[model samples]
Target: MNDAEVLMNPNDLVQFLKKNPEYFTKDDILRFCEENHVEMVNFRYAGGDGKLKTLNFAVSSKEQLDTILSEGERVDGSKLFSFIEADSSDLYVIPRYGTAFMDPFAEAKTLNILCSYYDGNGHPLASSPEHILRQAEASFKKHTGMEFKCLGELEYYIISKEETFYHRSNRIGYHESGPFCRFCEMRTEAMLMIARAGGKIKYGHAEAGSFTKDGYYYEQHEIEFLLTSPILAVEQILIAKWILRRLSVKYEVEVSFAPKIAIDRSGSGLHIHLLAEKNGTNVLIKEGKLSDTAKRMIVGILDISDAATGFGNTVPTSYLRLVPNQNAPTYICWGEQNRSVVVRVPLGWVDGVDMAADANFGLKRRSEKATRQTLEFRVADGSACIYEMIACLICGAIHGLGMNGALTKADELYASRNIFNEECTSFLKTLRRLPISCTESADALISKRKLLERDDIFPPGVIDDQAAKLRAYNDSCLSERLRRDETLFTECAEQYLHIN
Candidate 1:
């Protein structure tokens, strides 16, 4: 038989990894490649925009493996925005062994390993998004002896070309089933695929925005994941998006994770929930109340709400979804169960009840002590890179934790009531609103660069580069709008009404 026909099965490799967790050494990989007749390996990494970049190489001998593991594969760093200048564009892709997985979709039997970017001298790139996130995690650990556990509620719209025959209004698709929920089977299959690929899927369901017309149908859906380490959570977000995009093409549908797909429709959001933990215990809760550290972190995020949006809400269309009373927060405030505020401490947990009512009654009571108290930051959308958003959040929390008594006062005032209510109008006058436009948000990031850049969490010039890029993007959008219709700039409110 030929060498290819005598090679070990990819499934066998997966099982081998599961059985022997210590098989991550270079020697082990080389041995496996030699014995299994493996032909190629793929190295992947995330760019500044969270898009995946890949490098592939043949794995014929042990010499090549040793060279790659020791020196890494060089790549063109200039391809990624803000990474490097054309004069010194050389960077290396060093594989992160823990992120190794077999490519189920590849035509050949290949192993895909996620990698990190490093400079020519083997130093980690400061402008690298993954590196920034790792530094943030390290900083948080240094200050509090705790790590962050994060979960993402990723929402998106799926449009199909198949005919629906009958039509429905654009505003009623929440928890939909049967004929109206045309994408149920597809979403379920995607969720299963994600689970099989090592992602922890919490749930998937239809959202509250959909419409059916002529021979096309558009529906909103959400896929929420369970809490995990910050790095793993971010990696899973990228993986989930990759799965969805691939499946969408297979199903003959178009998927959009844009913050706002239509002018007057429910916008998608990438709401993130986080908890601080130490020694396997959630540190955000103590005696059924928010711990001092938790309060400080929340207040810190609130203090830098506008600046943080530059990373979380990166695109001009993101601001269109932040209108008041549209299930999107517009004010710089926090409150329990208040969706109108930038930060929300969801209800049920505060009253000793789980927010997930579908759990078994007995099991719910049994796991009460294990329940974690989390803070949900609701401003970010899919336009932002997960790494950048989390890094900005950690920086803000660090600043907040070191603030004086003013942070406490802001929290107390915001938690008193719904800040958007008519009765709270007088109080709202004293509070700041989130940036009204992408330009303003970029300016906020520049103004608050010192606060975010402390301790090298964000390398020098990183914030400036981010702000310049955002400004250029906003300018492009504005120019396009002006060319389409001269009155678009003057009548933006009427053109992009908040209907959700």
Candidate 2:
């Protein structure tokens, strides 16, 4: 048996290092490696392009393992992100103990941990995504006295060459099982690994996107994570993508989190469900209705959705997924269970109707008071700089909190029914439309960046760099060009199939 497979405690793979869990420390990490005979230490972090990068170390002694965990290592930050200049790009990558997990794909017994970057002066790198998120979180808490929490519903398509039986029809495989959902096993397996690696996982299932194009079968699946702070939420999603990519290689299949992998087909969206917590209670809902805080937050989001596109929808293909009549939103609006709007307030189990009574005839209950009500921001896709995305959101909410007429704005923009429905055409006219192209999105960002810069969370250089990247695509005419040519349209979508 390989050393990686046989551990002193096999359950450690499922558990958090098999000790005082959740609050892992340097000593705890060292102890786990020594006890489990871990041979390699891998430090991973999310790069500027929203991808995970790893630095590996071969640990032979306890001293080396302790030193690695305590002091960490240095790397050229310019390579991971284009923001920093090469002359002064050396930054320290320090392992975050709480993110430690066993690497299932490593041939040797490997311990993997996510790291945060720091400049040579020992300060958090301002350009670092995680650092920016941390600052945003702190600023929001300081002003609102509530912690911003988020959950991610990450969707992606899996492509396989085999034309097997029970092929599902396009856009009809939601929550499917068995033969109908060909990739259920792999999906569950991915969820298991993600959970074991400190991800606050909710569930995994087949999504409503399946297609057979050009002799290759493309099916969609989603892995959603439970609510956590913005920092950990982003890390879990990035780590999940890394695990998916690793498994894809072993399965000899291709995977993509791209917004639009196929023209006129269902596009994958990284829908982010947001909430604010105070004293361990959700403040987004009060007495079964949207709270003032929630309303203000929604208005804030709508106010900045166009400019925020530079952060959420980074790729040119992102706009391709946001057309009207599709599940994606083309206008800025919010409503309860309204898919036509950018923000959807899905059913939140807030009825207090004991759901467990249906499963068990007689069951004891306690004072259950954890609210699942959240505002789902549906615009963000896979091709996003998640840190910047959440930071802008936090800033927007902060600004809305202070705005005198935010509540009125929310009421004015609320859609009782699907705005895209024929009957509501006149009402939809009142709502402002979100940007539809990379060029338009960048233009909005540059024009209205003050919303994101309210708390100095996003440095001007950061926003400018993002805007510059979007403008480089010059996609103002991309939609029209793709609409006219079928081959060019599909080819364009396929190229950006896996920007994550």
Candidate 3:
């Protein structure tokens, strides 16, 4: 789209607003077109597999939007990592009308649109992640009349572009604060862009990753932010990463969402906060009883832990952050405040302070009734496929709720602490660790859980292809002997489980 083709037409925009009053306003639409340097604006509806089944001009004076609508946008479908046949890579990126928004970062009146991949004839691409998530969500609702809400905390590290390899390599402990938290200015700029793009964020602040008073890194602090829904959170996460990457490039700093950077430093985690609603009430919390539905949902989560990990913590680097004794779970268990538990059902809303303080010893306590209660899952990382992971978790929970599985609590787990410890030891002896290389994970995924068989999240050959790419990624990392890996096998690390 050349510069001349992107201008907005007042008449078309006024008409567009009349049709979608909530989405577009004449002034907002005009500002969006003028600010983003967009060349054209169009809308499309695609099938479940991300195939564009239909495309039409929504509003555009620029020839670029019209050109793509008429001529189509081409992409190498084979390179999409989750699809088959790189040679049949020719695909189209059809812009979705409902997804259109202003890109605050672009110099021109650039409009942001969500797109789906499709064949030359506009057939939906099978196994598209977005489509798969929609299917999973629908299936879950069909089985259990329940909806899942998810919020993800993305934790990462930012380093100065000029920092030496030695400094980055060193385990700086809990002292890497102040100047070490590079790109504050850029982060603020990125936040503004994100806000303009409709990213509803609760707050953004410095995490514990800030260097300590003594100049060491305190890895435990997470940059927590609130989000409205799982889907929105996923979009915001990707955009945040994208924006951060751009900021890094501009500032000459390195940014990483990897789990572990050093042996002793705190590793990153993507802790997801989840809740459910039914009949306009909080199902996860009602009249003080943990709803039968909520308990069953927990069972489903435990059941699909293994399969979920492939997407939840997809990167090999994620394991580096899963070490033992890091107050992270390495076992499949739940406790009131036990950091070792994979799932923690905190007390009700009223007694939060006391419960949290007393439960600090890993004890379970009830709280005053509040409707905004939730459950926290502690084993995910930033590398996850947001759509896939959330869907899988929701489905598992739905399965549990539908089946009415046994709900295990913190006190019960501790009562059998010794037996559980012995079982953990025995299980460790027999259980295989996930692949440490991206290639290996991809390979294991191919041979063990072929993508096609697993609800078609990725195409038939996509897993294998992704695995190959992962293998290349692993080889590029420092050798295992000399590399600084997180303490994954230790006592305090968080463990992801698989349902057999």
Candidate 4:
């Protein structure tokens, strides 16, 4: 472990302390541990073999760091999933101070800290989910001379695992609460867990198919929740799923982040919002037109759009939700206020334009603080690797900015028509289509090695391994021969614990 204290800037630390004020004194942590009857903190790390290997950390006084350091632990890194392979299965997890959060579900104040994983010989695991993001951040800063901040709105489902198929009676539309009216209590617990985990709570509520035919019954039972950024958002999704699953266990049901439950309705999407700052100025916001920098960002995403789709929606069935006619982005295009388009410059006031474009759009000069701008990239889904996906996006933006790729001269770039509207068909015709299956996506990844290989953005072996695994699975199952596999159908039911 590095001897230096974690050096977050004063402003960043203040931001953290502000959102999460439930700081625990060392005594508070030990006392809570004693009272809760909690014995150890579990640490999990990926081995080179790509399997999870877990260890436990004992609770002790702050001074125990030296003692704990003396009491070493060992695990085979080659068996871990994240690392490629390890001649030595040696890996250790050293907890960082100050990350402790009381587990709300524990009877006692059970504290947990995010652990750092290192190889037996003491090398940082490059494949750890967090490590991937850190690398992406480095690339982002180097290429764009800006720091990237991200936020997301996660949409998913919480349902009874018992009822596999709902016996349709009278058609109900959105928000028609019933057995599905499982929100109120779960929302309370979810908020508590998030707050305890040091995350600011954003509101959550029912989205489509509460009780209407428009609800699209079987497939569309879902909910939407928002989080401040990638780390917290992924954490919330995992925690929420766990909480909901336990609650469902009480009711004997299940929950999942799976993008598709059935066909013809919206699949869950992890829609991301990105902003870049250089020396405290919002790089993407200027005059009327998006900054050439922002445009470059968009171009990078558009260029390698296909290669990144593997993580955006991991499952083979994710493609069903990405059809051209459906809500998902089927092509690479950006327009103002368009959903069918992959990138959308959200509608805003004339003052919202970036300063770089202000002269062109003819806006009066205003303080940067008065500026508000947002860009939406809509390809991601629940199954994504939060770290990898965000890293790829940041890199893409950097690439775009470097190439001045946003210089594409479309006549009506600012048009605000609905992306799914009739006009989009013609405009979108020039764009590429999302792969219809996971195999297709994997294939694209294998085929486009050069594009992703630049900057060593995506490690080559990662893509190859993923593709080979998918191919082997498909080959074994003979999935192509079956129009729809019963196992896949059952897996969907299993995912949500809809047991009927």
User: For each candidate, what TM-score against the reference?
Assistant: 0.87, 0.95, 0.69, 0.75
Please, what is the whole-model Cα lDDT of each candidate in the order they appear? 0.75, 0.84, 0.54, 0.56
Candidate 3: list runs displaced more than 4 Å: 1-72, 161-186, 211-227, 346-348, 351-370, 408-500
Give the per-residue lDDT of model 1 (tens digit) for 404-442.
Answer: 985555556574676767899887887788887778888
Error of 4 at 253 (Å): 3.2
* Predicted candidate 3 versus true structure: per-residue lDDT over 1-500, tens digit per residue: 22232232222332334433235433454455655455545343323222223233344554444455444577665555344466666877765443455544445444555566666777766556666566666666566676667777767666542343234333333423435434445556766656544455555554554343233323223344553556565666666666666666766655666666555566677777788766656787555666666777676665555556666666555655555667566556555555665666755455245656565886665554446667778777766766766766775676566553255432233312322355657544433343444554555455544322444444545444445545655633433532444344321122221100
TM-score of 2: 0.95
Q: Which ten residues in a row have the lowest lDDT in candidate 1?
A: 491-500
Count of clashing residue pairs in every prediction? 0, 0, 59, 38
234-350, model 2: which lDDT tens digit per residue?
989998999998998888898899998877788899899999999888998888888999999888888888887888999888988898877888889999998888889999985
Which residues of candidate 2, in runs, are more than 4 Å off?
A: 1-22, 169-171
Model 3 error, position 234 (Å)? 1.2
Q: What RMSD value applies to candidate 3? A: 9.4
The prediction achieving the highest lDDT against the true structure is 2
Tens digit of per-residue lDDT, candidate 4, span 317-417: 55656666566787667777777777777764566345555567765554454334667878887667566667667666766676632566323333356
